[model samples]
Target: MQPTDVSVSGIGTYHFVYKHDPQTGESGFSHLITPLGTYRTFSLFTSLGVERLTLVPWALEAGSQNAAVFTFDWETRVPPSGFFQGYPLARFTWPSGRRVNRLWAKRLVVYDNIQINWDKEDLLDSTSVELHDSVNEFNIEEKRQFGAGTLVTHVRGDLTLAGTKRPKPKRSGLLTYTYEYEYDLSFLVSGIRSCLYEPSTASPLWCHRAHIAFNSWSGYSISPLGANHFQDGLSSSLVLSQTGVQLNRRFDNSGRLLTFALQDSKRQEAIINVTFVYSVDSLLPSDMNLETIEDVPLRTHYRRGPGGRIEGIEYETVGSSRRRHVQVSYNEESRISDLRHYISDSQFAKAGSSESKHITTKFLYERGLLSGFGSWKYTFDEDGCLIERKLRDSGSIEDLFEYDAKGLLRWAERRVIPSTTSEGQQKTKLEEPFCNGLENACYPQEMGQVKDYAIQYLYDAEDRLVVLRNTLEIDDSIQFFYAHPQHRNRLTSFFHHGKGKAYFLTYEQQTGHLFTIEEVDLSAAADSNPERKVYIIITDTEGSPIALYSDDKVN
Candidate 1:
């Protein structure tokens, strides 16, 4: 037997396969399984024919086995004249167990009149499914000349389920389902054509009405759901028209209303309003853009404070788009002092009531560098470093600095008066020291209150730093070690914190460039996990060269 011919109401399983020519360089294939005592059906809708194959296994009674197969070639007829639509269809059933149905459609066509089959199972319910019409019955020509026409569809049933014990139900059940789709069409006209005809000059002379809807499960519900209206552009800026929402109440609830308001000016009057509603929450931001707020104009102003610091600032947008203004003020210590806002145009009259305060500042410079200023005086060493600082207010506060023979700041001690009346009483607040300048003068070598951390620098004959050693503050505490090239230009720096480990790094000699880094011998450690090894590679400007390659898995 042919693969397409499968016995109905039998105890066996059936398998079907289908193949077709590629469309847009892609093809689809599906496999279906039918259980025993049931029949299956397949359907498709397309302008092209389909090749199908089916396999059925015969019923086995008392150690008896048999196999059966069938194949079939099906094609849909082309359209006669105006609109043409097609889909693939199939169905199957076994004894009294289960039944399967399927249908496939490619492109949907629309014309003056068209009919669709709803029983076609290949039509999957999806958000992308839509029905469109070319010539709407509500157009001006149809209303003024031909009058309204009827659009309907007739659906057929599955033959296998027709006379069976439990026949398939009607296509449209009691509760109807409505689906509404909305779209806009616009065309631009030349200036010369627009000048001759006032409507033509308006660019988009038509604006579609909102709240049009459609229902598919109601057998056939037709009205202005597929309607189009023309508009004049001379004196009107916006046009509103609608369809289908009137026939189905559910359609009214599911449909959307759109408003097309137009404003055209010679300079900057063109505007478009987009309203999107989802459930009970809505978002609206007026005149917002990528950079600035177009709905409000902003004026800039600056306020001065002690030591030339900004104390207060205000932004005024009077006679602006929203008639709103804002002001902010700060105190002598650069703290926010006051803030005020006005929403009405008349409130701007109170802007003159803003208050201002005056502050005084004194300067104390050592070798042209600010050592200490304010209500006090300070002095520094010859190298332009703060050696002593004195605060001359109610109480006395002083800080003394000391340097090593190598001219590096070694230590500093601070002294403050115990109380306002006890001018002679002093107490030490803090004491810290520095060992050497390794990385740079700004980043010292020895740092911390306990002098537990120290760093040593090795320089070449030319005084160029070649290598650096970082040590812990405790005696004989060596955290880790690093080595650098003697040539300063070829030297590279790296940082690591660990114990009993060697880290390796590759660098370019000529450019002093770092190429790669690898941990030398920690792979066998108890904490090592194979998956923890990470590899990183660096590329050049053109992404061509492997400038660096680092891996944590090393031994």
Candidate 2:
């Protein structure tokens, strides 16, 4: 048996293991239990393979075992391939005997003759009625194509082919648009392929041929995902002689990425190369090796237990004296209990160097929930919302969080308690905010604090923060406003009453916070151009702000 995927739920983490039958050459799983045997369940398979795993907790009465089982029902019959096809998940049955039926478009035409499985439903089921009902059936209009295989081009579906029901016009509702595909073919001179022969023994010298590749997507009107700036192909070396660069890619038998290399052909050296190694038995990533232009090799090795859970990781720089090792210890419930980090200059030290710095983090759990870590104690409400977090060593209440019935954070309080002196006098009070109780509190307000600070939040109907009131002496209240219906929940501008200033923000669809315009003294902005400052934000691929650029400075 080999471990496949690990599922982590609100209760516990469960590992799914698959047993292979040598005689039948088939993969299947019968039953699975959590590490501590707290939950038992099995896999749910449909024509589309395993959909989800059910959770079955032990019941006091033996006859109720089957009643505790959770299940999912899927339509096994394969639907037609064209147009808006494939029905959404049928229903979900919970352990408490509750069932939810879902219906919406779950597939879309992502490319010519290619449709991808994706959910198009919003939280409130605000999708257009025509779009929602068009997913279950197919039409002959969708099956018509211009060509076959790589040259195929699909016809756009007309509004007449849409569902019969028309949705009521709403200013805030989403507008569904149909897709159109246009293909344009163009060829580029990629590289020059040459054949060489030994000069001493060959009568003829060598011949070279120019390699040209053609690309078509309606004349670049519709490129693939990510704009198709880079080349993607099978496991092979793609040499772009025009740029003197070589892109080398390798894949395993199962089509998993194994290695990728980018080289400078003129220098005859690799600019960057990465290799991925996976465990033979479980097919899990075991190691990663990277080589840079500086020729410094960095390697990371993963150590796993019998159940394929990562127990430790070692990072090393080849030929360098620097090394770091991280060891993970799990409790009987298979939850990470401790994490120890050891850094040393000696690479081959088996027992690790005693002189090296060692840092360890310890975790404690109560009733399957993390209760404390290090010197910090945490308390949660019945809904699992963190209510209070206190530092045991310092005897200080770090944060007392309060949540409303909707599970939204309403307020948070931090208290600082001064220690007693030898003469029974109170120690110096820490520089912290002092907040008084407000209206509509979720968690009980904590008492006994030399100094305290609190912040209360107010949300709009759409759950967008509209106001923030803090106990701070300055900037006590900040009100946020959203004016752009297209951007939805994004903030358009915010006013700082104490500072008498306002900030207008613009966002890049993916990167976020493209520019911030700060206005000072809103009262004097009627005729005067209030002092304004603009700051540009830089972000990474994942839309996380990495740096702020302003006045020739990056922060």
Candidate 3:
């Protein structure tokens, strides 16, 4: 009997055909399936993830720290034409954490909102090289019909803190918002609407989402983690014409994003338009521009070295433009040995003109190991662990970091530089040099003592950070205590005391997760300034809180 077509669910299922949009998705890459166009695959859907299915994403991108990646096996062959096909399967890169190069290979992505395909197979075989080296490839010039698939997203705040500045204990304070959505054939708001998100809305906030491009498709947010992983600076917005909100997206033959623009009810020009540029062999964008219809376009250009590593980037934008030129260098061992950043105005090109007011930051490394950044230098103990770090950016050691023998951090101090005054920023003339290798001393009059401005941390035998002490000003002592106040091997209590205000948290745990967290405000003397106790209650097995209540109100 011939193997018939059957739908499968979950991971690693058998006896079903894994096919790309069997007959749909955009034309170019989506339609091309296996190398032979008859191969089967054991495929699974993924987000920005690593190659190993059993492993979880170790770290997440908060902004543009790392690029977006989907279907990680793209470095070799093309994915079988299954649910999401057309993306270059062989363009996948397992990047190093530092973004040695900000190239198109890092954040290549294809959304199902565009063309999609699936692969089909009869069974799972351990001997199939097609499963390991299979990469999703693309074709050109295909028209596509899209659908607004199911999308779920929730974004919350970072609720749990370590020593001080305890977050609100209400479950409401922990969630920015939870979103559930669906759309018809075209991706539009099927039920609920999308909204704006304020940073301070939650403490230990959490965001979660599973789909893309809903009408309310405001921001690319929400993950199981309280982490921000979208492309840097992705925002939450509505597309309102004089009639209502509108969302639009366009893609080219290889499924690379051409533009993501929003139109509104007012019929004003598109509020936001993001365009991408790429090399033919790569699925990621080598250059990108994100801007409003009326604003000067902010652009990002990636530079690559002979090995395809990102050597530098030219970023033109506001706020972050000052630190635009990021250059990276490697050691003979091929590890990142140095990083340099030149801060200048957006108009300053990479010309070798002698008239550039570039604020240069140079990184320092010991051999191939990172030692410090810019004017910061360091000393290490015998064990190769970092010991002391001194920042001499302004001729004086503006900051110092010290660690214990076990590599635990012990002390950190930062000197506050006074602004230029009538004395012109406390100018000092030194006629005599310091003995041997001693550094010059320049302390502001505001600093009463040489060793006063610092913070200290203490850890337990188990290597858990347990205590923090602050001495920001002369004779002002602020301390916080952390202990396993409820369950063993768990620290649920954090008492913060400084200034005249204090915050205390009592974490409630069930099944090793936060169940309810209560917070109280206190006086400097620990007199316990009585504030209403805020409560966070979890109602699900995943420890997702459904309600956050405090003082007879649900927030």
TM-score of 2: 0.42
lDDT of 2 by residue, 1-555 (tens): 366556553235566656667896645775566666544546545456225545454442334444355666554343433432553345566554445444334533221121223233332122222221133221211121333332322222122212222233211111111222333343221322222211122321122222223444211111111111133453654443334455466777776557766655455766666777887775666887877665578898999875778899888888877667778888866778997766556434665442255566688875456788766788865444688888777675578998643456878888766555432333322332321222111111233454577877655434567557665533456656554323457665666645656665544322243433334444342324556555544332233544453443435
Clashes of each: 42, 7, 72
lDDT of 1 by residue, 1-555 (tens): 326334333223356545455664423333344432222234333334443444333222223443223323233432222222332323333322122333334333222232122222222212122322222211100000111221111111111111112222211111111111222131111010000001112221111111322223222211222222222222112111221111000111333222222222221432322222223321211121111113333343344433334333344453543232234454322334344433333333466522222222434332234544444566754333467756556434566665422234434555544454432332222122321221111112121232222344322212233223332321221111112212224322221222222233333222333433333332233333322211222322122233222221111
Clashes of 1: 42
Model 3 earns a TM-score of: 0.34
Which parts of model 3 have CA positions greater than 4 angstroms off? 1-258, 262-267, 306-308, 316-327, 335-362, 393-395, 402-411, 416-555
Give the per-residue lDDT of model 3 (tens digit) for 70-176. Answer: 22443223344443445444323222211111112332222211121212121111111111101212111111122332122221112222323334431111112
- CA lDDT of every candidate: 0.28, 0.49, 0.38
Best by lDDT: 2
- When sorted by lDDT, best at the front, the candidate numbers are 2, 3, 1
**Residues forming the 10-long window of minimal summed lDDT in candidate 1:** 189-198
Poorly placed runs, candidate 2 (over 4 Å): 1-336, 339-355, 421-451, 472-474, 510-527
**Candidate 1 global TM-score:** 0.20
> What CA root-mean-square deviation does each model show from the true structure?
39.8, 18.5, 21.8
TM-score of each: 0.20, 0.42, 0.34
Question: Which one wins by lDDT: 1 or 2?
Answer: 2
